[model samples]
Target: MSEVQFACSTEETHQVGKPQAPSFTGPFTTEGGLTAITLSSPSEMDQWIGEWIELAQQTEFCNAFYEPTFFQAAVKNLASQEDWQVVLIKEDAEDKLIGFFPFVRGRGPARLSELSLWKSKLSFLTSPLIRSGSEQQVFKLLLKHLRTMQPRVDLVELPMTLAEGRVHQELHRLIRDNLLTTYHYDHYSRAILTEGHDYDELLTENIGRHHFREYRRQLRRMNNLGQVEFRTNEDPEYGECWADWFLELELKSWKGEGGSALKQDPQQEEFFRELVTSRTRAGGVEMLGMFLDGEPVAMLCTLVSQKGCFEYKIAFDQEYKKYSPGMLVQLHKMQRFLESKRSPWVDSCAVPNHPMINRLWSERRSIEHMVVSLGRPWANIVLGAMPLLRSLKRTFRKPKR
Candidate 1:
């Protein structure tokens, strides 16, 4: 095999007005008699990434779940705080960009070289930018790169969209077949708005059944307390106050409970703070507070984009739990969305099956996982053993329906 060297100068490679041009030039012949190439800069990979997303839209699992700008923003934010690297892969002769993976350096209590540098923030869902016909091939190519790059990473954590079945399943199969070390975390959930074929029709369908009756019931019940109202400030100037109040409610809700919000990690807090400010500027942040007797009892912070409204955060006074203030706040938010006709869907975000989400939204969303490793003998042995370990662990537990 012939070897070539490519320089790693960012400014020289990422010149203005040529976003699609390759930064570095190299070549490799694959076992399938295919050639592989690499691009060095994120901007250079944009054209192919855009094409992949367009093709991804036609796939069955496609949803407005991931916006390119959101990913870009997240990448920028994560990169700012940590040592990270972005890898772009392409098929050799075809000149088609196949995948992009943004990874960070591994740090923390876990042993170094035992895991891949993973993202601390939960924003980017790992979906490959692959053409329909080349999904498996593209994934295999990415695995080859990851394996070659593994010494720099430890464990790899790629969260797949549950709706995208093939990639995740293929990844699992590959891990077992190759014998790689793996762990699975079933965290996060989403609520999908369903009811109509179109946005307006969906809202119409939700009116009496979802929004009206429930919201009216809550209002009537709270009316005896004095007054119940939902409020929002669209002006950007009000964002800081909104964030402060929302954070207070969130922290209070988890005051005694051992939950994520109670951890009070500065990094996560900074991420949220930046997220609120940035999204607000883009008109993507919607802060909704519910007032009972003219006092705030519950609040929700939703992210609004062209795709839909995401229920990112919600909290209600524990004292008001008897009245189901959280549920009441959600209903009002949904009703407000319906009234404004601003967005087509409202995602409950990723959470396990909760009663509120299951009862309110008719549509279901999924979370996916992917494992990519270098096809090394040792890696294969470890990865291949995971299924057996899982089976053995399951055998010791009580059976469930």
Candidate 2:
């Protein structure tokens, strides 16, 4: 609401029903004169997305959710009253953008405030946007400033972020000097692309030629079932055919029975619609479908980001599981993707040890759930007890037979 606060922004009232832009009044400072701007609204950071992407190009970690289109869509679709900050960190010298950390400030135990990256369940990667080499300095600036926030903030949680990425390493490096006690919870597994090999060759080498041969056999059998075909929607002009088919296909799966399908979740459906419709014409969304006699059997959707195309959500008709329709369609598209070399990689966006993706991709992207104590006594207790609680649960679940 203040028109002249913060350091890296110029606040202007847009009255779009969300918190107004935070002003960059050059007040929030850290070591080396680094300053920050936190805007409660996503629109306020629209102007900086180009710079954000430019910086991301030089880093090993990138989550497509940081893209302006995707970020705005998620916040608009998913309402998290307490969780959303379009943070920009920069140097006071030339006032250049050095870091972009879009997060949801969290409410933790004992009323301590928290800075967290993974906001919605839809967010697969929780990495911050910062150049590769400047990671340490940027983290220092952030932690130092966070130390001084009013009402006393504590606890920094980065859920579903890469454990092997630069951000995690930098956080550990800073813990030695800062008043931060950190803990890593190995929560999820992710699959990554392997380079320098053809998709077919990789499949043969990893899944084995016998399995590949069986897949081919299944494809032939499916052809006999009908006019089998694999289709992709990428042209900006293409309408919502892909989404309609995908929803229908997904509804027939277990997710639909469990009431987790897109149509069942209003927020998810809204987010998916905007993400696909807004980017379809720009080649920013890719939809792949597998069909038998024009009947949808499987479908995969992805959001194209600066780093690469990321698998958003996928589904298959369980009735056609005998033909492995989902795997077949994904394989066909992957072969083309390999040949196209679109963005140098494809993130499976699948959970680690995922029975499907891990076996197919043969590469791992390390991810972890983490927490940092912001020097608060309550935060320290929460962080200290979390692991113990998990351990107790694990022990209680052990079979005694």
Candidate 3:
């Protein structure tokens, strides 16, 4: 575990990562005087850290994954290749950064060369970093550049992004205006906790009386096991310790036997540690744990951006499964979200129709996968057929009933 050298502060400063001089020279500048620079390494982002941090602060749509602190850890530890491209869009008039997009030319559906948005295993959001007031201009310039690239990017796919966010709305607007060609698929809703709902009333309304009684019964059983307590770690000095505990606790569960825990992969462990250490002082990351007699039985890792929270990951010791320690911790977390002065809403970041979260959080957030034609008619034709292809695939892939 790495010790974070910082003090807790309500406000975060852009003084992250060591400074490095701009290594790439002669970036491609669009005719509209917007400079688009693509770097092959996340470390190259050091030169524009200030602008990138500022853009994250003023982004039109909030994506905790796109934030510099999270991006650095994800790219450095999780990226599979050096070919990943970090595209930064800057306006020439005022020399201000308007957008940040990470891309990679990879094999997409049909094994076609696709300029796909780069996202790691745990990143659930793909909304690009676009300056708040400059979304329109940024999108226009970005799409135009993508359309006219030298090698000719015929396909660009955003694997995961908010379905109804401002960025998605702009994509729709551009498509309706005949400025772009695109295809959307895999649209689904995930569980979310929304504001203004009393947690007790929500439970009374959503959970069946008998089911709620059983849950309470399980909680009472756990209380009988030992001194049960729910606690959260926000102190910078203990962030690394909390992260370590989370990893160990997760490994004591089925995830470990299945080789799916963070400790199962060294790189994944490193990423989690660095992310916690980096964001500890800024208060962008937190760990909530359910402890029995001072031993953790369940844990949750969360990412905070602006006022909203993303429940990024959760794990529980299987030894405590009978008492449902995982769900119990979530119950406490849900209560905290509702009663805390912070934002009332939280994105579970769980898979669609997740058994546990869907039952607990009645609200939903729409997300989708989108592909752009990038001004290629042939690609547009293929893109148009994707939904049908997907439908057929699903029909054939379903298990025989």
Candidate 4:
């Protein structure tokens, strides 16, 4: 924990009706003779936010798959719905924005006497737009800034996705060196296109395979019960109808057996609805559906961004499981993805070790994990006890069948 200092300028009195404004003070000193400043106003933060994002995008580690705008929009959406803080870090020497960390107050009884906060939406995997300089120095500065606010935050859980990157690796190293308590959780799925040299060639290759013959045979069998057809929103006249059909099909599919995909939870539904509505306006949302007798049997919701189409979600009618409607729907979606001008790869986010994603997609990607702590002896003791605690908890649970 650090000390809190109150500083006041003549302007500060007008803003908060106080002679002084409270600011957290910490012991971590800046490198390169840089000073730390926190921006409290959103407009102030936005002033140099664009430049900060540009720096991150220009970094060698940047991936087009995670667009800056998407993250910015997501952060804004979360902040608008709740009381949260968005912090911006800049170099005092040049006043250059170096990092952005969005976080909110932690809700629950405080086990410790410290106020707690968490990264907004477990945003560890999403890098704070950092400039291309000494990453280690910048990261150290960022952690120092976080420590200053330790009185307001207890545990920092960053659910970093696709962790096999240098930035994440370095972060883990720092955390371990400092002896912080950290846990790694398996987050999402990644899949690669196994059938093509390029997008068009891959579609052609898939269609020419013996599996395509079997697909057609199954389609013929499904059609006998009614009419089996693949529908997409590429056409203007059919676009809105297809979108609605996709949503309905997703609700009725296996996902619906437990609960409707989007409608399963109100919050998830809200997130998807907002995502689809907003992204569709930008010509990003691509909805695909498999219809039987004009009723959708399976549906997939995807987003085309940069050079890839993301298979965001997919579901199929449980009754049509024997007919493999889910597989049929994916084949149709992949075919459309290959033919589109978007990009050459389709990202099948994350799936369990199921036959669909594991057996079908040959390309593989690894997600990494790291633990961070504040280099305290007590912190190390608590972290050390976690594995033993987990083992004891597991011992008490009944074995699964």
Candidate 3 total steric clashes: 0
- Give one digit per residue, the lDDT tens place, for model 1 in 1-401: 33244443234545488454334543332435343444333444465555545544443333322334445545545445544445555554544455445555554112334333234355534554444455566566655655454244445656554544675566566667766655454535556773234433454464545664655676687778877777886788777677777666777675425456622656556656766776677677788898877678898887775545667778877877767788778777765776677666677775667767666666766664534335444544555666677789889988787
Runs off by more than 4 Å, candidate 1: 1-5, 8-83, 89-99, 105-117, 121-141, 150-156, 165-190, 195-215, 255-263, 338-344, 370-373, 396-401
The window of 10 residues in a row where model 2 has the poorest summed lDDT is: 1-10
The TM-scores of all predictions, comma-separated, are: 0.66, 0.86, 0.88, 0.69
Off by over 4 Å in 3: 1-24, 31-33, 109-111, 388-401
> Cα-based RMSD of the predictions, in order?
6.5, 4.9, 7.4, 7.0
**Per-residue lDDT of model 4, residues 185-238, tens digit only:** 344445665334463445445445676678768888998998778766665444
Model 3 lDDT on a 0 to 1 scale: 0.79
Off by over 4 Å in 2: 1-27, 30-33, 47-50, 53-58, 92-94, 109-111, 396-401
Determine the C-alpha RMSD for candidate 1 after optimal superposition of all C-alphas: 6.5
Residue 41 in candidate 3, Cα distance off native in Å: 2.7
Scored against the true structure, residue 86 in model 2 reaches a CA lDDT of 58
Between prediction 3 and prediction 4, the one with superior lDDT is 3
TM-score: model 3 vs. ground truth:
0.88
lDDT of each: 0.57, 0.74, 0.79, 0.56
Candidate 1 local distance difference test against the native: 0.57
Residue 237, candidate 4: Cα error in Å is 10
Best by lDDT: 3
- Per-structure clash totals for the candidates: 26, 6, 0, 6
